[model samples]
Structure formats: C-alpha cells, structure tokens
Target: MQIHRGLLQQASDKGLISAQQVQPLWDFLRECEREQAHERPGFRATHILYYLGGMIAIGAMSLFMNLGWERFGGWGLFAIALAYGVLGLALTEYLLSRRQLRIPAGITACLVVVLTPLLVYGLQLGLGWWADKGHLSYRDYHTRVDWRWLLMELATLASGAVLLWRYRLPFLVMPVAVTLWYMSMDLTPFVFQDQDQSWALRKLVSLWFGLLIVLLAFWVDVRSSRRDEQRDYAFWLYLFGVMAFWCGLSLQQSDSELSKFFYLCINLALIAVGAMLSRRVFAVFGGLGTAFYLGHLAHEVFRDSLLFPLVLTLIGLGLVGLGIVWQRHEARISARLRGWLPEAVRELVERRG
Candidate 1:
C-alpha cells in the first residue's frame, strides 16, 4: 500500500480533502515516508552517490581483485583489510552518532561486511589449509565454483548475520544473499563427493537453494514492521531468489511437449503467486518465462508458421482488453474472490499482510 502523488489528486477531485490542504498534506506524508525510523530511504542525490561510491569501492577491492594483491602475501593482505575494516566501522559509528546519516552509515557498515571475506581469505592463505584448488587466481573466486570457497563463504554468512542482528540494517542482506548464492555453487563438489559433477546437478542445487531463500524472504516479508511503500527487507532476497530459480528452471532440456507445457503452467502459477503476495519480482520472472516459452513454441515447434505469430498478436491485444476490464472491476472482483476463500485462509492472508 503506497500513496503516490495521484492518490492526493484523487482525494482533491473527490472533495474528500480541500484543495488548500493537499499540498501541505502531500509534503508531510512525503517527509514521513522519507524519515520513517525503520524504513529504507527513497532515491535521492545523496543516497544515489552513497550507493554508487559504495559499490565502486566494493567492486575495486573484491570483485576486481588483481594478482598484485597477492604480492602483499597473506599477512600483508590481512593487515590491509583489517585497517580498512576498522576505519569503515569507525566512520559508520561516527555517522550514526554525530551526523545521524544512517544511509551512509549503512553503506559504511556494508563495506566492512564486504571486506570480511577478503580478510578471512587472507587468514586461510596464511594457514597451510587453504585449498588453492587448481592454483586458481583470485578472479576465479567469482567465476569458478569450487569447494575451496566454503570457508570464506561460511565466514561471510556468519559475519553478515552478526552485523545484521546488531544493526538491524537491511543492506546486510546483500552480502548474506551473495554468500548464500556462492555457497550453492561452491558446495556442489562436497555434496557429490566427486569432481566429475554435471551442470544439471549444479542447476538442481541452485534451484532448491533459491527456493529456500524465497521461503526465507516470504517469512521475513510477513514479519517486517516497515511494510509501507514496499520498502521491504526481502527485496534483495526476492531478486536473487528469482534469478537462481528461473535460471535453473530454464536450463532443463525437455523433448516432450507435455513437459514443456507443464513448465509454462508452472510459470503461470508464479504469476498468480505474485499477485497473491503483491511482490512484483515474481510477476517479472513469470512473465519473462512465459514469453520465452511462447517464443520457443513459435520457433522450434511451429517454424515458418505465420499463424502462430498472428495468434500471439491477437492474444496480446486480448490481454490489453482484459487489463482494462480488470481495472474497471478490480474492487468487485477482489471482494468476490475474498468472499469465496475459507474463513481461516482469509484470516491468514489478513494477518500476513
């Protein structure tokens, strides 16, 4: 439930609120939404720069780590990361306590979380136990999936959990979700107990791991107190969850038409689930999957057939017509559907919302 500028206009048009009151009311509500104690910030110049700078710093130090970093050796790497982390934490505390710049504070905290894996990796490197699988380069850490990453991933998840618990900051979920995704790939070898694992098995791991994250996201969504304007803590979880699940589902090769149709049906079900949960990510993924399935049929099954495209165009126009009808009768339709649900189920929905 969000109150956009149009809603204010609607109230003025209906005489529910005087025209004189609208501007001041809108200004106050906008401020409330911006400064809501537990809510995330909206897009603004300061926030944009904060995130951009943070991301650039994260990318430089982590994702784009060069072999030159190894020149420092394990102890030197550990020292540099420790210095950066301590400085980041100090700045975060200062911002929170003195400047009250919570957005920057969150970014600074996230920087420390991002640095944790590198710090832990350095520690592993110093120890003799580091796998150094295939003598892989640091860049391979991101590109290649290997069991050697387990220690760093575990440390990252642990540290992220602690920081999230301490600060109640939703930004921490980014690192946690990323580490979980990494673990989903890196753990495949250990799970299979062999090096000759297939791509199908890897995708299968990702699919279930993604489902687990989605379930966790839903649970968090239901329990979050900052539900206004869809500024949810579950946003990153949903984004990555859909990515993993959709990729895995798309990778499967099915020769049977019935199996392909079943996949289409599953995607349609995802769209319905999106509507029920009021989460747009589900709808986005579901719609894309449905479009892909249709394109596959048009090309692979009905190659050189003009009839299918013409039918698809008609179906597109029909869907637009359905949208208009839906907009006009949405209230009545929703009320009727709600009435049909059992009392317990309706109550559950209400409570969850």
Candidate 2:
C-alpha cells in the first residue's frame, strides 16, 4: 500500500500520470513525508539513536549521580546546571530553527528540563533554605522521598511547562511526567507531616495521583484529536500514569477473593479502555495485571486442580475465537461503538482511529 517514486514512475510509464505530473506528485509526497517526520517520531535507526543518547545523558545527571559530585558546593552545582541549560537551549534553537531537525531539538530541550531540579537544588542549598540536613546531597532527590524535594519537583514542572509551551515538542513532556510520578511519592510526607506515614497511605496517594494524571492525559488527547494534531503529547503521561496506578494497585494486599476478582475486572476494563482510545500503554499494563491475577489463581487457589487447566484452556480458546470474530467485523464493531458515544466524543474517537 506504500507509494514510492518508483511506483509513480511506473504509473508514468503506463500513461496513468503525465511525465510532468509525476515530478510534481513525487515532490508533494516527499514534502508530506517530511512534515510527518517532524510531527511524529518513528523507530528509524537515527530516531533510536537520538532517544538512546538523550536517555543516557538524562540518566547520567539524575539517576547515576553519586556523592562524589556533591563536593561541588551549592553554588558550584548551580553554575554547572545553569551552564548546561544555556548551552542546551542554544543548541535546541539551532537545530529547530536553522537546521529544521525537530527530533534533536526536542532532545536538547528535554536536557534543559532535566537540569531544572538540579538548578533548584543548588539554589535552595546556596540560599540556606535547604537547612534540613547539612549533608543532604542533590542525588537524594531521586533515591529518597522527602517533602524537602517538593521544591525541586515544582521547579522542574514549571521549567518543563515553559519549554513545552515555547517549543510545542512532545518529548519535552517526558520530564514533566516523570516529575509528576516523583511528586506522587514525595507528596506523601507533606500530606502526613507529623503523623505515622503508613505504606497504605502512600499507595492511596499514588493511586489517586495516577488517576488524576490519566484524566489529564485523556483531556489532552481529546484536545489534540479535536484539533487534528498529529503530534502525541499525552504518550508519556499515559505511560507514567499507568505505571503509578498499576504499581500502587498491585502492591495492595487483600485476603478476600472478591477483592482479587475485582482487581482482575479492573484490569479487563483497562484493556477495553485501551482499545477504545488506541493506546498501547493501557493495554500493556492491563495485560500484565491480568497475567498476575491468573498466575495467582493457578498457583494458589487452584493448585493440582485438573478442572482449572480445563477451564483456562476453554477460556483461552474462546478468546482466540473472539479475536477472529473481531478481526472479521472490526469496522462494523468500531462504528457501533462510535454510535454509542456523543457526537463530540465520536468525532474525537473517529479522528484518533
């Protein structure tokens, strides 16, 4: 189904398109391809390299930082971070405006965002506002969950928001999503300052925060769909939101079989929602959760029960049959689903589909 210059030339040879029209058609196609490349990131080797390099750089500064670097006092760290931000912004501008390389520009913009927390950490330390512990290292920002890290997280969110607004790049949202995930944990202490902060409390906060983020992602998705925007700004939000939600939900302990079955149903609902939205992140997490519940039943509730295997096999086969039926009637089924939605929502879903 792919059309290439060779196909156009073949059409020209067949007298389908005039010789002069072939070149113009090919040029239009090429321009469309270029515009799509700018709007949507692909899994091309160069794109993979860009993401890999950006991740390595981000990890080096954040997750991989060691106490050795802490020797660079507050002002020193601030100066280094500031320098990186300035240089990164300069490079981003060059790549985006001059070279027209959006992927590299996005990566550079994300680098500046990744430095936001470090910049805030240095600022707090130098200004004496960070008086919690004399030996607190900025590295602890990732390793430990303290209310003290809230300022840095807030600063990161602000910096990411500003960058995203100015550049309108999807990759810039990655840091913002990560910061929100971190806040889901760090906010625990702030919520229960002087009380006995229980693990259950933390899990509840994470679960709610995750739901909030997912709702936010859905809103963004709807807005983008309504605008016919090709860029996916909600991808990282969905991913991190699902991670937080699923991890929190999975960590809860319950002896009641009803609760376990409820968990399975929730995951199944997630799969259905994923199908509705055309989002793989939801389906992936939902699949993992479903597998976990099934594993639990097989190992614990139905160990050595011959009926369990038979039932599971029947269910699997039924799913395969259902998949076949769905494949045969996917268009009709999708249309029916859209018909069940309101007009505005249907339009959004159709556009996304």
Candidate 3:
C-alpha cells in the first residue's frame, strides 16, 4: 500500500499523471502519512522510546520499589505519591494542550494512573484499615494476592477511568487493564471467604474474569472504531485479557487425552478468531498453547511411538505450507471471513486502526 516518490515518478513517466503534478502529489501524500503516523499507535523509533521511558519510570515507582521507601511511613508515602500524581497531571496537561504531544501526554497520564494504587494503599495504611496478613509493604501490592488489595484495585480502576475519560488517551487504558488483572487474583480470596485459597479457585476466577475483560475490550474496540478514533484504546485491554485467560487455561491439569485434544481444539479456535479479527495477541497466545499441547503429546502421550516424531515433523511442514498458502490469499481469505460477520461488527473490525 506504500507509494514512494519513485512510483509517482514512474506514474508521471507512464503518463498516468503529469510530471508537474508528481511532486505536489508526493508532498501531499507525505504530509498525510506523517499526520497519520502521529495520530496512530506505531512501533517507530520515537514511539518505542516514549513507551520505553514511560515503562521504566512506571516500573521504578511500582515493581522496582525497595524496602527503603517504607521508611517514609504511610502518611509520608501518601504525601509523596500525591505530589508525584499532581506533577504528572501537570506535565500531561502541558504536553497535551501547550505542546500538542499526544504520545508523551498519554504516557504521563498513564503514570498518574499507575500511582492510584499506591495512593490508596498509603491512605489505607495510614488509617490502619489494612488488615490482610503480611500485607505490610506497599510493594506487596504487585506480588501478593490478598483481599485487602481489593480497595486499592478499585481505587486504581476508578482513577484510571476518570483519567482516561478526561484525557481520552489510549495508553491510559493500560493501568485499568492491569488493575483488572490484579483484581482477578485478589477477588479469589474474597470469593472463597475463610477457606484456604486454592489454585483451582484462582484459575477459574481468572478464566471467567479474563473473559469479562476480553468482552470489555471488544466493546471498547467497537466503540472506538464507531467513533472513528485514530487511537487503539483496546490494545492493552486485549493484551492483558488474553494473558489472563490463556494463563488460566494453560494451567489446568488434565490427565485425559480427550481433554488435551479439546484444549488443542480450543487453541485452534483462538487462532481462527485471531485471523478473523486481525488481532495478533490472540494468535500469539493460541500458538503458544498449541505448542504446549504438542509438546505434551511428544513427551507423554506418544513417547513410545517412534512414528509420533515423524507425524509431528509432517504437521510442522504442513503448517508452514498452510502459512504460505494463507499469505498468498490473505486478502481474499480475510474478506471472506469478514463477510460472515454482522454488518456492524464487520464495520468495526474492518475500520480498526
């Protein structure tokens, strides 16, 4: 779909366009491409650096926190977090309004969202409302699963929503997605109530909660597409949702070969859905799950069968062939799949940025 100046020059030489119009048309196209690049999410060098810097800062404040920070105490930590949030909001506003920078503005807005859990945790600690055992450190918010973290997750979700609404930044959805993932774990304890926590309960909760988030992500995707927004606000939601869902799905221990085959079928369906929707996240997870199932067959189910290796080798080659075939007719295949969708959903998926 790319049109270079050389192509335009060729078009001029072929009399498709006048020589005089070539440069002007090329200039217009370049400007349009530049504007589109700025408006949409891209993995270009500058965008990568923007997100990289933002992630490092966010990680430093959250995941990489040291015990030394606890010396500040609950109220002190609350004050510090408040100051950071205020400064981040100010910078976000400046980046958006004054400098017309959406990427950096989104990053700063997300940073503010990242601080919400800390803010609430600090307030809870200060008020002596934190009751979960061994939940003394704010850093435990990321590591431990406890019902006590539910309030922090709720606060984070609320603040993230408010910030996302106010700023209309796609990146602001990241913290919201992450908070939902965290809440999926914390809510397990609450659901079980006084009973000892079990992996079965956690996995089931994660599976169901992840499905809910994925549905939410789909809704957001449709809404954003309908609005003709240039940004992908549902990217993070889909990513975290798939991670949660796939992790839970993969962790289930099944001894029956039929159950394993069913797992493989589900993964195949995921791959199909991914191809239909043009979402690589689903494809990635689905591919991994498929590989896991295959590995299980090789190591356990067919260990004594020498033919299994040859069969797997043929399957791999067949998949490669399938990929080549898919690549050759991708446009036609995509169109056919899209044709089966409801008109409204088809429009949203087709118009995805």
Candidate 4:
C-alpha cells in the first residue's frame, strides 16, 4: 500500500505521465496518505527525532517518574504541575495556529493529559485525602495495584476528555486508555467483597474490561473511518485492549486437554481476526498466546516425546506455505471475502482501510 517515489518516476518514464506532473501527483498522494490514520507521521529523520524526544519526555513524566517528586509537598507539586501544564497548552496553541506542526501540537496537547495525575496527586496530598506517611510515590501509581490510585486515574481520564474536546487530538486518547487499563485492575477490590480477593475474579474483570476496550476501539475506528480523520483515535484503545484481553485469557486455568486445545484454537482465530481487520495488535497478542500455549505443551504434555517437535515443525512449514498462497492470491481472496460480508460490515472495513 506504500507508494515509492521511484515507482512513480518509473511510471512517468514509461509515459504514464509527463515529467512535470510526477512531483505534483506524488505530493497529492502523500497528502492523502498523511490524512489517514495509518500513514501520517512519516519516517523521516526529523519526524523520528520528534517522536523520540516526545516519548522520552512523556516517559520521564509518567513511566520513569522520580520518587523525589513527592518531596516537593502538595502545594509545591501543584505549582510545578500548573506551570508545566499551562506552558504545554500555550505551546500547543502556538503550534496549532501554524499549518506545518500538527504532530508537535498533538504531543503538546498530550502533555496536558499526562499532567492530570500529578495535579490530582497534589490535590489529594493537600486535602489530606491520600496517605500522609509518604509511602506512596509517583512510581507506585504504575507499579502498585491499589484502590488509592483511583483518584489519579479518574482525573487523568477527565483531563483526556477535556483535551480531546479542545484539541480533537487522537494522541490524547493514549492517556485515557492507560487510565482505563489501570482502572480495570484498581477497581478489583470494589468489585469483590472479600479482603483477600481471588486471582480468578481479577482475571475475569480484566478479560471483560479488555473486551469492552476493544469494542470501544472498534467503534472509534469505524467513526474515524466515516469521518475521514487520519489521527488514529483507536490506536491506544487497540493496544491496551489487546494487552488486557490477552493477559486475562492467558491466565485462565484449563484443566483438560480439550480446553487447552480450545484455547489454542481461539488464539488462531485471533490471528485470523488480525488479518480480517488489518489490525496488528490482534496478531501480536494472538501470536504470543499461540507460542505460549505451544511452549506449555512442549514442557508439560510432551516432555519426553519427540513426536511433538516433528508435529510443530510440520505445522510451522504449513504456516509458511499458507503465507505463500495468501501472498499469491491476496487480492482475489480479499475480493471473495468481501463478497460474503454484509453491506454494512464491508463498508466499515472499506472506510477503516
């Protein structure tokens, strides 16, 4: 689906178009691709550096948060967060006012979303709502699974919504998805009555929450397709959705061989779903589950048997063969499948792709 400039030039040389027309046509096509969710943020060196810097900054604030940040006390933390958030918003406004910098603008808007939890944490400390022992650090927000983390997560989602309202930046949803994923785990205590909640119950909550997230992502994907928006509002949703679903599903206990086989089959179905939807997240999770299941079989069921390796090898070769066949007739196969789908479903797929 990628159009190389070389191919375009080759076509021009072959008299498909005059030499003067190629550059304009390439520019037009590139613009169209840029507007789609799957294609923007092209891999130029500058663009790569842009995302790398953005990710490092985001990680410093969220993932690798320093515990010393809590030492600033509630008011001091609030002041810092307020300063950073305001600065980020101001920069976002400036970037958006110009036509050439949507990516930077979106990243700046996302910083507002990232600062939500810090602001909420400050408020909690100032109001004496959080533990005063200073045992909870910003790092614990991600590492420790506790109900005390709910306030920050809630505030994050709210801020994400507000940012999306003001900016309509799809990258804002990444924080929303992260907060929701945390909520799925943190809400476990409230969902169950026992002080010592069972892992099974937790897994069930995760599985259901993941399924819900996936459904929401699919809805957003469809909506974005309908709207012709290229920002990819569903990317975070799909990423976290599969993480939750796959983890939950993998953690389940299957006592019988038939049940284990069923699990493997479901993973295979997930791989197929990935192809059908053209979503890599599905394939990544599905492939991981399949490999884990195979490993389980190798260690637990086929420990002394050599036959299993032979079977696995044959299965691998079969998959390679299948790939070859798919590559050779992908267009025909896609068209045939399209013929079988209902009108609405086909339209959605067309819009999404």
Candidate 5:
C-alpha cells in the first residue's frame, strides 16, 4: 500500500493525473482487469464452441427439410455459410482478446469499413425498388407497403439484434438497432394500411421510446459520474436511438409548423438535459439549439423576400461578434464571480479557464 501510494504520487508529480483523480483512475484500472479476466481465451473458446454447435445443428436440420440436398450443393450457398462461420469465429476471438476490445476504436472502424457501405447499398436498393415501382415521390414510397419486404426487414433486424446480444457489442448493436428502427418505418404503412394513421402511431411510440432511452442514458451517466468514472461511449448509442426515434416522429408529421415546434422543443430539452449532465458536447448542442431558434426567426422574416441574404449576413456577424466578446471578457467574468462562488465551483471554473 505504501508503494502504491508512492507510485500514485509519482504519477501525479509527472502530471499523468491529479491527486484528486487518482482514486477513480485506480478503480477504472481494477474494473478493466476484471473485464479482461472474463474475456480470456478459454471462456471465448467455450462460447465459440457452443455457438458453432448450434449453427451446425440448425444447418443439419435445414438439410433434412424438403428443399432437396442437391439445391444446397451450390458454391454460393456453401461459401456464404463458410464465410458466416469464419466471420463469427473471428468476431468472437476479437471480442475475447482483452487488449483488442477497445470499444470506441473498434466501433469507429466497423462503421467506416462495414456499416457505411452497407447503408449506402441498402439505400440504393431501396431507391431502385421504389423507382421500378413508379413511385417518384418520397410520399408515394411511404404509401406503397409490401408485406413480404417488411417481413424480410424484420428478419434482418432480428438477426442483427441477436448478433449484438451474443457478442455483447453494445456500440455496434446500438447503431444497428437504430438503423433497424429506421428501416422498420418503411414497414409502418403495411402494418396499418394507411400512411397517416400508421405514421402517427409510429411517431407516438417512437417519442415514448426516445424519452425512455434518453432518461436511461442519463441514469447511466449519472451513475458513472457519481463514481467519478468515465462514461461509456455506448451512452451515445442511447442518444442516437433517441434521435432516430424523434426523426421518425418528425417524418410522420406533415404539418410544417408542428414539426418545427416539435423539433424546437426537443432541442431545448436536449440543452437542458445536457447542462444537467455537465457535458461539454451537450452544451455545444444547446448552443446549436439557440442557433436553430435564431435561424428560424430569420427565416420567417426573410421568407421569399430580398432581405434573406441580409438577415443571414447579420446573424453571422452577430454570432462572430458575440464569440469575440465572450473570449475577451471571459477573465473578467471569472474574476468577478470567483468571490461569490463556493470553493469547489471556483476551482472548477479556474480549471476550465
């Protein structure tokens, strides 16, 4: 314990960390070790074996079905199955390797290498399908509901959800789940057989779900904060899910005024929530909300008028001026407020500056 204390002191002296932050850093280190133990190769191997056995059992069952053995002899089907097995094994191994399970890094790479192209291809296919069906307008595409397509979509979403659960990959799962929900919207009309009712119901459900996710995320953040720990990036997953849910809600409402109002309310709520969380990113989001409000007012004044450019230019200048003034006056603001603030608050402000 003395040696540990000395090492911590040395670390603090080197500016590797502050004395106050050492406790949380030590706790995080212990947590990582615990997680690493769970992700050992032996445990991973057992998990892989179990999944492989299940896959084989399913494949064998499929082979016994009415679809003749000859049909399964095709190279494409065989290759696909082989690839699936190989990829599953690779993914399992990667997850089980303690040092390799860098959640943020892994997810960012996966999004770039996998999700981005997948989404692009899916969008192209969806567009082509719509075009072939003579649905030129976006609204027309929503009206045309195909049950078979919707079932396929649901199946795809289920498969993704299962994969996420099995691998315990929250980062990948969150985005995939959100994309699944978005794709699910295309199926809404088929379920209700009317765009208006279907979309309205979808929006209401989405709003509820969004609020739930956001609140859950905040709870998670607060829990972590209380422990003086870093929050997981998966918290952003909850945010994305909430955002996607709201996007669906926005699409459902055709009334431009109502949509704008709803969007403003949501942004304002985000700002409030972010402030409470003491998140810099969320504070930036709040700033964005303010900007959006300003833009909306400007839009109303300049709508279909020659004053549009002038209004935009004035807004831009005003924002730049405010930024400069803030930067210049920041020290004065800090000094003046320091005497009235608590010690903790003063320290926080000074550190931020």
Candidate 6:
C-alpha cells in the first residue's frame, strides 16, 4: 500500500496522472487483494490434502507388500484406492462447478502431489520385477529395465500426457514425457544389443518430439504476444528445455567425432535461440553451453602442460565477453526504437517490430 501510494504521488507530481487516478489504482489493488484472499484457502487446503493423500497411499502400499491378501489386500487395493481418490476429485469438481463455486487450486495441487509419488513407486516396482528376472542387471534396477518397469513407465507417461493435454499445459509435459521415453530406451538392454539401431531410434524420437514442442512453444509465443501477455517466463524455459534435450542426446554420443561436432554446433544454436527469446534464458543457455565447452576442452588438454588449460580459459572468457557485448548492442537498439515514439505509436511499432 505504501509503495503504491508513493507511486501515485510521484505520478501526480509529474503530471503523468491526475490525483483522481489514485482512486482507480487503489481499487485495482483492492481487487487484487480480494483475489489473493480467495485463493489462499484453496492453496492451503490443496497442500494439506497432498501430504495426507501421499501418506495414505504409501502406508497402504507398504502394508500390502508386507502382508499380502490376508492382513492387507495387496497391490490391487492400492490401484483401486488411487482410482477412487481420482474419481472423488472429479465428483467434487463437478459439484463445485454446478454450485457456481470457484474450483479450488488446492484440488489440482493435491492430485499432482499425491500422484507423483505413486507414479515413482510404480516405476520402482516394475523395474524391480524386471531386475529380479534375467532381463535387467542390478537387484533394484534403478538404471536398468524390466517388463514391469516398462509398464510403469508407459502408464506414468500416458497419465502425465493426458493430464497435460487436459490442463492445456503441453509445454510442461512434452519435455518430461520425451525425457522419460528416452531414459526408458536407454535402460532397456534389448536396444543396446543393436547399438546403431537403438541410437537412431532415440535420435529420431527425440527430434520428432522436440520439433513438436518447439512448434507448440512458437505458437504459444505468437498467441501470448497477440494477447499482450508475452511476459510468460515459462514459455522461454520450455524452449530451453527443448534445446537441452537435443544437446543432451548429442552429449551421450560424444565419443564419436561427428557427435562432438554436433554437440558444439547445437550448443551454439541454442545460445542463438535463447538470445532471441529473452535475456535471462539466453544467459542461462549460454552459461550451460560455455560450461560444457570448457569441460570438453579441459578433458582434451588434461595431458598437455598448463599452457593448454590457460589457452582454453582465455578462449572461453572471450566468447562470454562477446555474447555480453552483443546483448548490450541489441538492448541499446531496442531502447532507441522504443523511445523514439509516443505510447500509441510505440504499440504500433511493437506490432511491426
């Protein structure tokens, strides 16, 4: 309130706004306060439900594993309980909608929190079963595949995809699902037997899914820009994740000269894309790429004298400095363009610019 008052006073003093403007601004602030108040209960309730739900699910699973069928029902009971919980949530949402009451944010939060752990547990059980059999190495199969593990992975991925699609948060789920699918293939020993085929499949899947995410993100950016809501930082983060996925795939094959070249080129491309999107994301992508480049250079120079490391350090610093200078140049150009016109004119210019 104090900050807002100060701002209003300054604006009034500068003749940028009239004293009458203060009342409207205050009303806006009050509306915002009301919305926050309305959201608070839902937020708190959702978090509490999340914790309680997770505990119940875990406890039930543990009991079933310990005393199957007699004292505890078994894994089937856990699945049934989860399904019931989901159905209950749906029913509650329907009731609330019919009553014209606001749908609580906590409900969504609770569902996400509860489901996350259950999904992980299912993944572990499936992986464990596979490992116990001859299909995978390691008794627990943390990094190896089992049939049960594949089923869990598929279920989790499908559920997440459905949730994302339902919520219209495709950017959030696309990278995650892509990553899970990639990791599943990596852990599956059957794929490694035919290394080239496996590698090609992974690359193809990643590229195909990555392009989808990229196109979706671009569409979002366009729509948000049109709606004058282009400040969404999540969109930029999603783009970075997409770029990271491609870069990660390249790194996995770094033993090959072609892969090493691809990694460097892709990192550069990511840096360019980030620079175009937003400064914060650009800096993040640049920092990551720089780190990888330095790591690779250091490895190559490890056997050489101190001169090699020093030279690489100098080159890396130069690249970072160059990026900073380029960013400053772009900022100056943007500022000049924006400042050259009045408010209405600026909006018109922005549309074209």
Best by lDDT: 2
**Candidate 5: clashing pairs of residues:** none
Q: After superposition, how far is residue 207 of candidate 6 from its true place, in Å?
A: 6.4
lDDT of each residue in 128-151, candidate 6, tens digit only:
532444433222323433434554
- Candidate 3 Cα outliers beyond 4 Å, as residue runs: 6-16, 131-135, 316-336
Task: Write one digit per residue (lDDT tens) for candidate 5, span 1-353.
Answer: 22355677689999988999878777777788667654332346654664455445433423232324224333433344445445544655564574465443233323322223223223444445434534222222223344434433454455555555454444444545454454556556665575564556777756656566666565554444444333243355456655655555445544476667667786777665454345555445545656665577667744677777787789789979987997899778657867786665455444434
Distance (Å) between predicted and true CA of 323, model 4? 4.1
RMSD of each: 3.5, 2.9, 2.5, 3.3, 12.6, 8.3
- Candidate 5, residue 348: the lDDT equals 40
Candidate 5 error regions (>4 Å) = 1-82, 98-100, 104-166, 195-209, 212-233, 245-265, 278-286, 301-353
Q: Which regions in candidate 4 have their CA more than 4 angstroms from the true location? A: 2-39, 42-44, 131-134, 323-332, 340-344, 351-353
Candidate 3 per-residue lDDT over residues 243-319, each given as its tens digit:
88888888888888999899999889888778667799999999999999988988888879989989988988999
Across 129-171, the per-residue lDDT of candidate 2 in tens digits comes to: 8776665688888887777788889999999999988998888
- Model 3 Cα shift for residue 43 (angstroms): 3.5
TM-score of 5: 0.45
What TM-score would candidate 4 get against the native?
Answer: 0.86
Supply every candidate's count of residue pairs whose N, Cα or C atoms clash at under 3 angstroms: 0, 0, 0, 0, 0, 3
- Between 1 and 6, whose TM-score is larger? 1
**Cα lDDT tens digits for candidate 4, 195-306:** 4767999898888999999999988887776676567888889999989988988899978999888888988998987877778899989999899889989999999998
Candidate 3 TM-score, C-alpha based: 0.90
